[model samples]
Target: WNIENIIDNATLKYSVNFVEDVVNLDVSPGASGIGCTEMVISNLGTITIDVDVEVSGDNITISPGAVSVTLAPEGNITTPICALALTRSEARAHPVSVLALGRETNTHLNQVQVTSNFTAIVDPYARLSIQAPMPAKHCIGSTFWTNFTGVNNGNANDSVVFEVSNIQELEDAGFTFTLPILQYQLEPALLDPLKQNSFQNLVIKVDSENVTEGYYNMIVTIATTMDGESFSAATTYQIWMANCQEQDANIEDDSLPSISLIPTLIAIGIIAMRRRY
Candidate 1:
């Protein structure tokens, strides 16, 4: 049953026709020797129509002398990576489509056309996790260690590099010397995998300097392999004068010295009284 014959000689009837329906279709003609013209007709319910036609050209021969093709319009593809915040101005984000080439009817044409429809919306998909033996604030003279964990939900391992900086301004702002000045590093232990579920840690050390008791601030900057790509995070630690100040003040307030002499004196007096009796 050729499509050209059915459209040309069939009777199409409508059980109910209330309003006017107009069908419109457009198709790009194929190359000189490669593609064929696609025709489509749409109506409410079913339409039975009668037609008479004659073919004159040898190149225009019809198939079964025709074929039936169900025309389905392309649909929108959902982009999951859209949730990540990507800098579209500096970077272009792309997606992996599920539709494979072999399954496509028109491999080259349809696949390319469908790929154009997939979209990715940008968001903050990059995540960071920091861990350390102690909090960011430590004594100025004390050595404290910390770890920073980062994940490129946006890219893979070796995709980004990191840096650590010592900020003196953090001390001027009131960070205590009791809390050591901080430094940071990305640990080698965390760089094996680069997935949304994967993460790497940055090990940080706060080495307190032998200076006035004050606080300090530290910053960690992460950059792409090229350094131009970077992000930053920070923590604080401090060192202060020893804790013996209060103990020194308390000693000064004692009215008398705490001595064992009183017990020896009283025992001697009792022995002398017994001897006299």
Candidate 2:
């Protein structure tokens, strides 16, 4: 009997095959700013084969990196793999190797080298501006509202965060004010390229009663997070405070002469009418 030939024939009868030699993974930013790819493994052997899958790369990560499958004769298995960019600034091609090894024979049966190329599609950038009420004036112990506009100069969706700092520095500079809502997070919005969005009627309370009556200047900082990075911008706001008591006094003084002249004019009209009669 030819036992050696039989063994060689059996070894050559069973084999493994990959559907595609090279897989191209598009690591482009998705809804969650992450990228993913799907892969399929097929078995062309007559008997069930146990195969193990793995991926090797720095930026690319595969879910279920180790997959065990008992593929029937001419059966296939599908796997979903996801990858993300560690840093968004640099866009380049990342080559990753997906190797499938036979568990029983401990042999490398199939290899699919994937080239994940990420382009510099869009850069995240933000522009912030604030518009307050005309005259920027408020009385003591009063609340004022301002309008905030955030524009996404780049091609990505983002959220805006507002913060007020340097209160002590402003007070030392003879301008003291208070923000009722110090930290605010704006709702996330998908901004088109070079398009603007408005957050209307944001409130800020000024403590004019405790501070002196004058122009209070302070800095308002705006920050946004895009592609897991923080970018910030700042602007100065000038708020004028008027003493409530002094405003009332001025109103009364301006109207006092008009109130006194009413009586004198009535008397003069009566005297003139009597002389004519």
Candidate 3:
């Protein structure tokens, strides 16, 4: 065992070190309709590295797959990352991941990785729709009530605004609208149907105590706006003027059927004609 003493030397290695921002990356509209952000990645290790990046999410893309970094202890690169929604109805923030993988330039070893998590911004979309049934006829001189169903089909919480499109025309034709002129707030449409308040009644008074036998048509509209996007819906109301008779509520006629009914003679004739059409 006299000549067996020998010395051996080994090198200690450090893995590649990388750094990235863990923040809410703001998204801006890209050339067509896609949303994107500029990502800054840095190398914080002693060795130079060649890195490749990746993303995990729907419609997400990274501009350059790989970049070379020289280390003065820190080297940075800027790249464009983009994301988008599959449909206009889909609006909300979504979470995604950014992955950086790298290896030392000289030995092609000391492999390492870094992960950055973020949320992509997609503004909420809002839409409104109104549905009202055709109303029944009543005596021309009494007041009446009509109603409509408002639906917020958009993916966010929003209110619907009401407008009487042909307000002046109908008013000139011996009709009046009390509901559209008033404020009716709507519950956010994103709630469950069973817990939603989406129905409303419109009131009108006919000064028909001396009007004619014809009818006037009324127009109603519902609308909403969000983040520069707009949506609107419309419905029609017809006012039938006949010294008909008396029955229930005593409301006039414009966007609703009155509570009262006309005489049996007028009802019978109109019922027969209505059956044919």
Candidate 4:
């Protein structure tokens, strides 16, 4: 036999194609707490494939990391990916890597990397309280002053607005008052969590010309809006107003009898002392 024929007969050649090398994955950014992003994996191979997924990152995680997928020649599946940001302070871009492996060969066929930017948001909560004791009495045409303290109990920064309601209702019941500031801003900037701000010297004036002497109930509301959501706290105060002219007359009437009896009592004591001597 010829040497060239023997060599040609002994040699054999074949080709193998791996679909993982050319596969493409789609990923997007995720929102913290609110929701997650969806990532799609497509299989473009000649044979059915079972893909196993794994995620590597501190700020991101994959649901059902390992999946049993039977691709009919060419198929696709979508998976949910979530971001692990829990606080408002965790506002940053996070790097996440996803790897898909072939179960039979245990080979890493494809890797997809993404920079997920998550929104840092928390529930908004606040508490409102009167910083000073409510004035028991207010004179007509005089101003009543007090302080209100607001505390932010949530993790986010917020701004507070003040509202005074039931004023007209109180006026209907013979108690009239005026609030100089209908809507007062607590602070120019956002208030942080567990932080407090005071609204100093809030003036409530009794209407001298329009109000009748009586007691009235008023409601004060403190509200804050964040991310299209609203949080509010409310409190009530009782206001008592005395007519200035009537009050002066009553004082004068009560003092007149006492003033008239003092001289008579003094004379009797002098006479008693003279008799004893």
Candidate 5:
């Protein structure tokens, strides 16, 4: 029983060449990164394969790396095989370079091989965009509303509305607005119907003049709904004779911040400081 006659084997020589301008590897998790070169010999003809491959700067070379073979139509062939392992240190470390594969066989076995190169690139981080409205400041006798909007990166469609106020009708004698100094409401179906998130909250800033210079207070009532729950954000500010005079200052400023009290409808308001000169 000749051992060579009982086996069918083949030899495969493999080498690698890093392509030019294809370096700087950037790999992610669970990703196949640059590592080693492999050689697979299919349909072996009862033979022994001894592969000795050496890699240099961007190049791979095979030595005496051939296989000798004998074939049996139907039998088990056992042969000695050798493998070569290449590491990152074995290759040229350049930002951009190519590896070349070369083969050399001192045997009569047929040579089978292939080559390829990989590309590198930088990965980018993700970010989110948010949209919102600017706050508005208004004066007494000013019929207006303030609008606010905000988008959350964590909760894109979630937001809320809140309000505070202090209205005083007279001074020294102490007084309060006979009527609510300011009222506000949220638009865009506060708490999106589809998303079901909190509605954006708005805080109305009444011109300090909403009340008299004496002692006075103004009320700011804010209303909105979230998660089918009705919530209110309101506050009150003391108003006095100074508040009434503050309105004069607001009128003089001419550049008071204005807002669309009603959606689609724009109104004017004044922002000014009352200085006790």
Candidate 6:
């Protein structure tokens, strides 16, 4: 019998599945974050397959972006793929695709490929900061007003409301607060191109008309919210309530924590990128 050679095409059957349809990521405002899940690849056909996996997304990165594996019939491989999102000032839902290419032993026989998708969700957050100038000493029974700043430190659009956190404390100490504007709408803070802080300015007025001759304190606060979550920030001060007629030596001048001015430019929202971190 004469020796003869026969050739036939081999089929590579494979299946791909993600652990879940959605992966949740909690990232700070203007920050990068990572989310990971398992992906399983199975070989179903009679022939072994060398499979290569790849993933892609917008403004985000997939770790081990590409992977290769050799599987036998009825064999499977499970690997974790991570999504590293880029710096963002707002929350968003992103869709990423997973593609698998299988070659029968890389023999270049016909190649079969499959594609699937998973969603990456970034959650929104709220943050705030308030700054006021505290004078070293103020004469008793004198009206005091100073310009202060309130910044929307969060990564989303929000409204900030101004209030006196220690109303009773200030009131009992013969002090009262009056503000022309109480609420303000602000946008996300930008770290670059001017280092926009989404900052707002207001004048704080206090009536020190009542008689006093001791140390007094007051707290100024700003508040905002996101998804029913409350966020509040405040600045406080302690002043020596000495009689205007008293000598300078009679006033206490110990400064606590040295509360100071708010810089016009604040570096905010430093996010991570590229690899799974």
Candidate 2 yields a Cα-based lDDT of 0.50
Flag clash pairs in model 4.
Answer: none
lDDT of 2 by residue, 1-277 (tens): 1111111123222232333333334323333334555556555555555666665555555454565666766677766555544433233445545555543233434332222222212234444444434447777666555544443332334566666656777556444454555344443233223322434234555444455678776566666665555667666677787788888889988966677698999999999999999
Query: In model 4, how large is the Cα lDDT of residue 158?
Result: 47
Q: What is the TM-score of each candidate against the true structure?
A: 0.32, 0.40, 0.59, 0.50, 0.21, 0.69
TM-score of 3: 0.59
Q: Which stretches of candidate 1 lie over 4 Å from their true place?
A: 1-140, 167-197, 225-277
- At residue 129, candidate 3 shows an lDDT of 74
Q: After superposition, how far is residue 199 of candidate 5 from its true place, in Å?
A: 23
Cα RMSD of all models vs. native, in order, equals 17.1, 13.0, 13.8, 12.2, 20.4, 20.2
Give per-residue CA lDDT, model 5, range 174-263, as digits (tens).
322223333222223212433423333343433333332334334454443334334444444433233444666788765653454443
Span of 10 residues, lowest total lDDT, candidate 1: 13-22
> Which candidate wins on TM-score?
6
Off by over 4 Å in 5: 1-109, 115-125, 129-245, 249-277
Q: Model 2: which residue pairs collide?
A: none
Of 2 and 4, the candidate ahead on lDDT is 2
Cα shift from native, residue 82, model 6 (Å): 1.2
Ranking by TM-score: 6, 3, 4, 2, 1, 5
Scored by Cα lDDT, where does model 5 land?
A: 0.31
Instruction: Give the per-residue lDDT digits (tens) of candidate 3, residues 88-200.
Output: 43355666665666666677665666555555555655666777658667577767676666676665566566777887876766665555453455554445554456434
What lDDT score goes with residue 228 in model 2? 56
Better of 2 and 4 by TM-score: 4
